[model samples]
Target: MAGEPQPSGAPTKGGWITFPFLIATMAGLTIAAGGWTNNIIVYLINEFNIKRIDAAQIANIVNGCTALFPILGAILADSFFGSFTIISVSSLISLAGILLINLTAILDTLKPAPCENGLTVCMAPSKTQLAILYTSLALSSMGLAGTRFTLATMGADQFDNPKHQGVFFNWHFFTMYAGTLVSVVGIVYVEDNVGWGLGYGLCVAANLIGLAIFVVGKRYYRLMKPQSSPFTGLACVIVAAFRKRKVFLSSKSEDYWQETHAGGTKFVKTTPTNSFKFLNHAAIITHGDTTSDGFIKKPWNLCTLQQVEDFKTLIRIFPLWSTGILLCTPLAMQMSLVVLQALAMDRHLGPTFQISAGTMMVFVMLSTSISLAIIDRFLLPTFEKLTGTSPTPLQRIGVGHALNILSMAISAIVESKRLATARSHNLHGNTVVPMSVFWMVPQLVVVGVGEAFHFPGNVSLYYQEFPKSLKSTAAAMVAMFIGIAFYLGTAIVDFLRKTTGWLPNGINDGRMDNVYWVLTVIALINFGYYLICSWLYEYQNVEKNELSSSSPCPC
Candidate 1:
């Protein structure tokens, strides 16, 4: 008989165990996802013969789906199946999606006929074609969502050291950004120059390779079982608190029921914090709330003080998270618009060498990859040595906000200059402007730098502070922000086109600079809001003692 599968451990046994396999898996999956998505708008336009803005909207929908599906995956991981199973299933699903897309790319019947070079009217893709295309995207989006950040939590589970966990985060994102670089620069180039069929075929290969590696390393992974839904506990906390609203507040910490020790045993707990005092009522024992041994008689009637405090932590963190949603809206719009700009501007490096517009995102990915390595290895250490303290997540995120504000300003300025050049050349209505695509790099690079600080900061913060049971959800919350931002960006673009002349059918005729300016003002206001939230918020967990930090009450 085959050897029995390895059992789950405390994950403290292995010192930085399974790092290599996990990193490889991450890198491969990144390439798979990035390669497929990097040139999605170009694929839709070229193959389906769709209009520019319409193609962007579809791409945004894909991006949104990419962001949204992870939450479902995470919830299932935390409340039912574990991460490894989810990752395995998702990888297979994603592989299937890539294969479907590749099929579409290879077969002429799956897409509309290629438009003639000078013709304006082109055939739209058939409903059957659109159906297959959407099915492929949906499968791929679900696959990407389930595997990416859930793997982050899985990787972190292998490390006992808080600092080691933090270090893992850097490499995790570095792999992510680095893989994106390879896809956009290398694979997207193939899509543009060689062929889409081969490009998506490579994506399928990458996904399969990643899945195989992860399976081979399965025995080495740290595994955890599903517990009760974190959501139900949070809901109970709210309901119990409201039901006991009229109960007299307790003066003694000992009076509250604690999860760690409930019966005759001494335990220590900080009396619930003064902020959100109304929530403290959740722990107040009303009639029939508890049994003789101080155990909860009814789950909905009473919650442990820990459950009450967990709800408070989420509520407190909401503002900070909301700022992150707004933070990416401008960037998301700018990102989509930049590709269009690249299409209109000069992309030639010399007489022979020309670049793909889709590949332009490589600059952002490159900047993020390099900057993350520098920050994680050099800058953070140097700052700590000089200042005797490492930068807090809030501080790092604030820096990101500042950088974002600056990037928006730069984008507005660059777009203004591009517009001036376009106007001088009398460019209008689908004509290319005589400007260099290089003009767009500064803004893209700055946004990348900003992400280096904020993206990891946000992930690190959520991972550290979330209730242990909700770890999967914690990592996936950042995706929620991104998904919301992309959808919001699409809405904003639609509003601009309908309400104002700023975003016309052809950006050559539209005042794209004015849209950038509007985004700049919005970013500045959001940054101010971020500053206020960051100032008021205190760190929930800064220590290596996970249990003590997460539990306001411990025995």
Candidate 2:
């Protein structure tokens, strides 16, 4: 009977062990690249004399590039190369860019002094050097976008049976966060002691190692060949609509429009010319009445339109998912602006209490890791047992949004206290705030908790809603939203800095605690918006059941 059905435990054939290893390797490399760049924001402010706000803007640019290129990567991966091949090629390209950045540092070190007026002095690199640095950053950003979605999808493909799919997703998220954990410690060491060049060089080395591992595991991968582009999907919908119009107009009797036996199977007969003409004319139907011909036609392109309509309908039902965008804005701020604030604050870790910007990040990472594990392994299962139904991904996301608001509220309180401390001490002139940096830990921990709930839940929701052929594209959409949030946050911060005459005083002079409060307020407003959106979301259990019954194959 169907060859004894595939086991629910794991894939029996092929090298499944290599799959998780491959995913972990890629995750480590991506996290290293991301963390190294994120930490550079602090380095730029301290060493390059860049303003905190300006540094944040630069970081936004990097995030934006990474986000935008994913659309391109998704298109290529879906329409041209399979995910495995695309990821392999993209990883190497990213590695090359990282190496180029590292080489710049080596060049600087090797440069000799020039004699001018019999006094020897080392000459600094020109503006051209800076331009090249940015170019390399852009390349690396593109590489990241190209591989992020493809690799995730590829990892999921290793498990083919539906019963094993849940476990696969659990591991996928676990591996991603695990990679971020390694980066927090590894990149911090390179940046704090070894220098920026060495840190970036290490990223290059890590990426190369990841690429090699993936390549070695090629035999174990179950590759899905690329399909037609999303544009093709759209075109098919349009064509099907027109064809249905023709079928509608050809039949004239109501009986013809009713279900009838055709080829020993029931088929719905449709009206002829009138239905086709009606669609073509875009005539507004104000009343429900039988046509003169007594024939009626259902809407054309139901299959394609249903897919698009379901997306729109699902969006309307869950307002919270959309509002999560607001929560995402502050979340994005953590890696850039929030970190900058920490850098300007005193970070003295005594034997009993320790606080550093990088150390705070470890807490954030740990919180994220532990929270995700709890949710996937225990919380979800327990909830399912009680509710008799697992919570929809959108529902999970809504909970995360609420937690995000809490995170921001904590941030506001902490920053208010820090601001008061600065004002009381008349320590306004110092580059670093005099207050203990440990005050920021609560907010950071809250952020990590929020992320754990949101990121994986949102990803699962997007994948479920997307058409099977467009899974990568759907994943890219999720990434795009995050990129947009960062860009928008940067824009708002820039506008506020210019309008309030706070640019030079806050960012340049290092009294940015006030700016932090402003972000906190923005996040609260977003939380309110998120609540409104969440209220509108509808759980589509029926549709999900139908799809699952029809297609037994797991995504």
Candidate 3:
């Protein structure tokens, strides 16, 4: 009965009626987020007179925050506020941040003066200006953090069927990429070719529109009620297990606790899993652990079988989740570096047309969108038809790991060629390389293809495996790992700047190719680690249909 659409004349509260409004809001907000974040490095370099390397570092940190803060938002939504409230408040906060950023672009006093006569010695931004800029970035990142993954959970809540949820996710990511495509190509172009003020102002407008659309849909959404913190239950499991460490194992079913309904009827009739045997102590019944009415006497010393199993599920999935961090770092680094590469290359598409440096990331989005369509519409069904079985999320994630490593290798080779071209032309001291920007497209496209495979796999895996009480948190887990990876990317860049000559003030003076090669090696090692984790992992909550079919459709 889940995910069933209402009849045409029925006054239902959820289902297809909510889809248009949510998708529209997604597009508007994604455009708004990408409008500023995609060009942030360029904004820092050109507007604030920050060094290129410094700007890239700042961008990495900003990306880290944007990705990391989603977990907090997810926790709050799952524990205190529902998704709708968080989305609404976060949108307003985002609008404020965008407006402040626009003010900086409009008012000359908020930014440092432009570099004089192509000289490198330009006046730095005042402390007040830097503070304002940093605050705006923080607020914007926080706002985005609260809404991005939460929206996915909110949308999924409308559907009761797993197949419908899967379909919704596929379209959700497609909409995400499509919105980003418009921002990087359209908004970023305006920022580069027109003026920063107009570009940021457009972002402001997009934010307002997104907020308005979400607010107007209040009556139709199937809102989930907030519950007590799922994390507290997880903590209780850990504490109770440690407290009852000396308790003997119980082979008899009667010795363990099973949750019961208010009328003394058993609610769930399962025992703790054997995977994490030590934690099973938390569910073992002991003297005076429960009252006459079966209420827990010491909450921290005793936990239900379901809570113990949920905790164990987290323990099992954590290794696989850890694999994503290293896997993500190289990709993050590659993305940040590519923007810098675009700046030095000839970005002309044709006579009188030039691509903005920031717009270089558009290839990643474009290729991802195309790949998603192919995999969902053609590849998945075709594979199922031929093989009689669907690829598991782990399998999809493994393929993504291999492709990501290949992309890194390709990037190393391409960067080497670019460096060779620079040497051949005797280019140095901020001189642009004569190589075409299109040369970088292959690497970006490969990264995109890899993303299409891995990102959704991660979401599906976590959402399916996590306890139902933590649905929003489950969706946010992807953002958490990615956020950590971005932070790692920043650390790696800083380490390289301090320890190696690969990245100098001007990239042409350094060996940028060597950095790519290092990333290739790192990715290779990470892929090996990922393979082990994926092979060891067993699916805990795979849907019944997934065993036989790969199609997203319920039929």
Candidate 4:
């Protein structure tokens, strides 16, 4: 019974848990590298004397590259190399880039000081050094793109079986968030205090560590090699369409032939057994069928034009879901602009306490990590029992969106108060707010709660909903959503500065309270949109169906 007819290519028990952890570790490292850069922008400006605009531009370039290349990586993974190989190659590439960056930094440090005071004079990097920096950033971005999609899809592969699948995804998402928590807390701090080289180097190390873990668990991994291209399916759909036309014509001819053969006898209108059989297999349409015209017609098959039309018909019936892009926008800000904004706030912990913006992220990360662990270990099971329906990943995603709305609301209010306090004290000229640095705590805590809700839920949701052939594409879309949000946020900031006469004396002028208020308002608007989207979202329970029903393998 234990070995009773199982789903196609389902992994054994051991592979399920290990796969998620491996992916989580890689994700954690990527976020850490990004996070370190975010928190240390101010330090980079102050210590290196790099212009703020130049620093911001560099960061934007890195983000843009990171977001853009994932699509290509996903394509490669889905069409050519398998996820494991992609992950392996990407890890090595990222490691090499990080090492080069470290070497550059060390070289900079070793250069002779120009001042008699013996203090190291900051100098702009030479063209060669700058080119190296850009190259390293690009390489890291490429590597991340190559691996991100595969890991998520591979993690989902662990629970291909139906029985243990119920709580399987819950654990999967929990591990991912747990990993993020570690990156935000441990890795972000390391980057902020230690310097950029060390920060990126640590990220590389984390990637290597994750790769090692995956290597050791090779036997247990439920790996899926890339399948045939979507274009192949599209070609099949075209063939099927032509065959469908032929079938219709043939059916008409058969009806006419039967009428003539009756020869004055009344023809009994009997339904064909084959037609009834086809009806019985309607639920199995996603698999496909051999058509009368020598073409295989899969359910929602993209193989022929008619099949493509059938697929469209199926899509039309799907529930109207929230715009995932809008839902993801505010959540994406937490990693990018939010970090930069937090650093702008006075982060001094007073004489007795010392905390930088990057260090403060530890609290948020720890809180989120704890929350994720609890949710997986306890909350998910309890909710399942109470609701009588295991929460679909989309439902979990909705919860995340709701949390983000609340987090943004809190951020707006707290920031408003901070701004008011600063303005009343005539401290507008001060870059750092005079209020206790602890004033930002509420915002940070709320962000933590929001993170716990959104990140894992969305990842799991995308993995579950997307077809196996498009899993990498789906994952890349998630990354793209974040990138779009970041770009939009940056654009909005720029527009506000230009139109409202905001940043009156430019970014370094330090009177940025108005900008904060504007961003807070923007956050509120995003929260409202997210709420609407969440309410409209439809949930899909991929785990309930037998794996044989939906598994990618033909066998």
Which numbered prediction scores highest in lDDT against the true structure? 3
Per-residue C-alpha lDDT of model 4 across residues 1-555, encoded as one tens digit per residue: 011233789555444457556655555555545443444455445444554544554555566556656776666666677666777788677667656655655566522222233233456655665677667667766776666555655565566554555344444444444555566566666666666567666766776676667677666666665765564554454454444442422222122111112223223443222322222122212223535543334533323222243334224223322344455444444444444445556666556544556555556665676666667668877987899876665566566666656666666566567667666666643255555657666666766666566655555555565544444454465666666655665565566557775444223243344554554565556556655654665433336422111111000
**Deviating ranges (above 4 Å) for candidate 3:** 1-11, 160-167, 264-271, 542-555
In candidate 3, how many clashes are counted? 2
In order of appearance, the predictions have TM-scores of 0.90, 0.77, 0.93, 0.68
Q: Write the per-residue lDDT of candidate 3 for residues 430-449, one digit (tens) a residue.
A: 56899998998999899888
Q: Tell how far residue 71 is off in model 1, in angstroms.
A: 2.9
lDDT (tens digit, per residue) of candidate 1 on 187-211: 9999899999999999999999999
lDDT, candidate 3, at 120: 64
lDDT of 2 by residue, 1-555 (tens): 012235599565433675666666667566656555656566544434444567678877787667667777878876777777778778877887778766755565322232244322324434675677677777788777787667766666666665565555555555655675676677765666668677777787788888888887776666666776765644544554455454433233332223223333233333323312333211111123224543223333332222343334434434544564566677776666566667657877775533435545677777776776677678878997999887776666667777776777677677667667766766553246777777887877877777777666676666676555555565566676777777877777777677775445353343354555666777777767765665654444345421111111000
TM-score of 4: 0.68
RMSD of each: 5.0, 8.0, 3.7, 9.1
The candidates, ranked best first by TM-score, are 3, 1, 2, 4
Residue 128 lDDT, candidate 4, scale 0-100? 67
Q: Hey, what RMSD does candidate 3 come out at?
A: 3.7
Candidate 2 matches the true fold with a TM-score of 0.77
Please list the C-alpha lDDT of all candidates, in the order they appear.
0.81, 0.60, 0.83, 0.52
Task: State in Å the error of residue 443, model 4.
Answer: 1.9
Clashes of each: 0, 16, 2, 11
2 or 4: which has the higher lDDT? 2
